[model samples]
Target: MVFARYLTPAAECGGLGLQCLGVGWQQVSRIQFDGRVIDCYGLMMIVRGTGWFVWGDLPRQRVPVQAPALFVVFPGVYHAYQPDAGGWSERWVLFNGPSAHTHEVLGTLDRDAPVMVLQGPLDGMERVFESLFEAADSSSPHRDVVTSSLVHRLLAELLAVKATTDVARVVRHFDEQATGPLSIGEHARRLGMDTPTLRREMFRATGTTPKDYILRTRLSMAQRLLLTTDRTVAEIARCVGYSDAAYFTRLFSRRVGQAPSHFRKVGRPRGRDG
Candidate 1:
């Protein structure tokens, strides 16, 4: 069994969106766990053997598990797992951040389907786990940042494999209509899908709800326009489907951590002729 350890990152790490609290890989035998709750999120990848799991408020229904699978542990949610006849080999990481919470709300980090089956060769993911372990063990001042990035990388890898064709269509539609004053409900109707199904499919494919996805697309277009054109903030807001510049500014500042005007001024390179 590999050694496991937890960490307390520097306070500044929290500002980076996600913080790695602990990480390790282990092999277990004859382990029977009842249930437990934690304050942070956890992702456990089962590499070998089989297990069973259940989570909810109470009177939970158990889920059967197998190798090459992953399960999520939600904060404040009661969950339990145990190895089948044979034990399981697993890699696990604990993390929490505003970004993580946003994903949960957006339906990307699903609570209903906490455990997921991973496909394809896992060598790539194992390599990342190795890097995570090394970074977590490092004493460098930037260790937290490095480890956090690796965690993001792992999630990206998972998404890359999990996204389906239906999700691709949804993303394409969102991108095409990002600048229009269209509601997600309308978009769902256009696709002949109900709002909830669209949401579920979108979460399965992109780890975001339709509403969040369109907002991101709009803001992305707004950023491009801000950098490439001389449009006023109000004009840019309207271009992105926001009639209220003041409200847009509030959202931009909250998400991007700067006012639109400040972002344009600072993000652009100064011409040498000036």
Candidate 2:
């Protein structure tokens, strides 16, 4: 059996607003859990297994058989199980803390319904498992935040594989134009679609107007440059697609709640200030 653990601290719990207690992984056989009911609110992904789950007083329910089956168990739920006579192998993780939101995000599925099962075996299962494990074992600042972020990423990958799509083209386009100072009309012409049609399709596909998305992206780039580079505000403005420094300052101040110079001086370390 292989075992790993990751521990998170309190200070770094921000953004998604959850404090991760810890994450752990274990690969074990039936003998390890013979006649034991593990209790916790976390997740379990069966890399290899043929087993059933037994709740108190309930007849055993065969785990919906699948290679790479992922299960989510809520806190306090009664659970006990063993692999079929042939025996089984599986991987699992246990996490807890006020910031844990695994159960909440996956609430649509019955706790025992088996959240997802990859159609085929997946590579990198160990990396995912170990990442969470290391996060649980460490006490570095913001470990919990980082662990929670990784958890979301893992779930996203699973979902993406399960529902493959051609939206890659749209995503690529968004990435390319996000920080560019291209107008919606120019973007529509470049994509060979009329403005209204392009707007409709972009909104339908990405849920945001191209102009708004581009503005936000440019703002983000401007912020990064402000924090990490020594470029003048005017130069950074042009780099992020704002030809007019004053206009850029207005936009930045409106969105970030501070003047560009003040933001740089107060928000970033002096050495990092550009």
Candidate 3:
């Protein structure tokens, strides 16, 4: 049984200061990159089978079989692997270049820890990898442009999945209430539960209290307004649920580690802030 798929040579591409490398099931029995450095970042999708990942002395964690798992490895981190008896089959792309915003976007994950499991299938990754490989192997004048666009698409998918799993229910409520401010009491009412019960459930499901969840939700909105609009801090605060700008600033700084103004300067990229 082949555990790892070796990507075809045609799928390898180099340009835009980024080089894309991939392996399909036939490529090798196993693979490793950068020899477990602390700061290297990598995007890997398991195309088939079950496997385990061990990083930074953490116990080897089993990756669910048949479920697509996305892994982001940060620089200076040490990672090792052992495939299941069926062997872990996967597709991986490694690239570093000028427009390496993927690295920055991935930084959000890096701030907290080294391992994250994205909730999605690896079904579409093979095609994307194939296209990138072909573009790289071609001598066409538009090769870099085409490969860059594909890389962007791939990165977008990675970030999208990361965002989806990160916020969960809070994000659901935020989307439903995107048009205006949503009070915590009001949100609880909408969910058919009282404030206390809602708080309990939120904690049970997400490991965060309802109040903190709502605060983070609104703060996330406030962050967007700060970066993209000319809205005053007070207005943005009110838009998210805080009537007191000073209080909001305190809360934002507590959770985000920076004042709202500073966060605006830094911009909201995605993933956990602190």
Instruction: Go through the candidates in order and give each one's C-alpha lDDT.
Output: 0.81, 0.60, 0.59
Give one digit per residue, the lDDT tens place, for model 2 in 1-274: 5565645445535456444444555545555453444434556666676666554335644444444566666666656555655555565655454444543444322443434555533565557766767766666666767777776655555555433221344445766877675678887765534677567656766778877667776777877888889999999998988789999998888777777888888874222112
Q: Tell me the deviation in Å of residue 135 in model 2.
A: 3.1
Per-residue lDDT for 91-135 in model 3, tens only?
665555545655574543443334445554433556677776677
**TM, every model:** 0.60, 0.45, 0.46
Question: Which should have the higher lDDT, number 2 or number 3?
Answer: 2
TM-score of 2: 0.45
* Poorest stretch of ten by lDDT in candidate 1: 265-274
Sort the candidates on lDDT, descending order: 1, 2, 3
**After superposition, which runs of candidate 3 have C-alpha atoms over 4 Å from their true positions?**
1-18, 21-35, 38-40, 57-66, 101-111, 121-126, 139-142, 169-274
Q: Which is the better candidate, 2 or 3, if ranked by TM-score?
A: 3
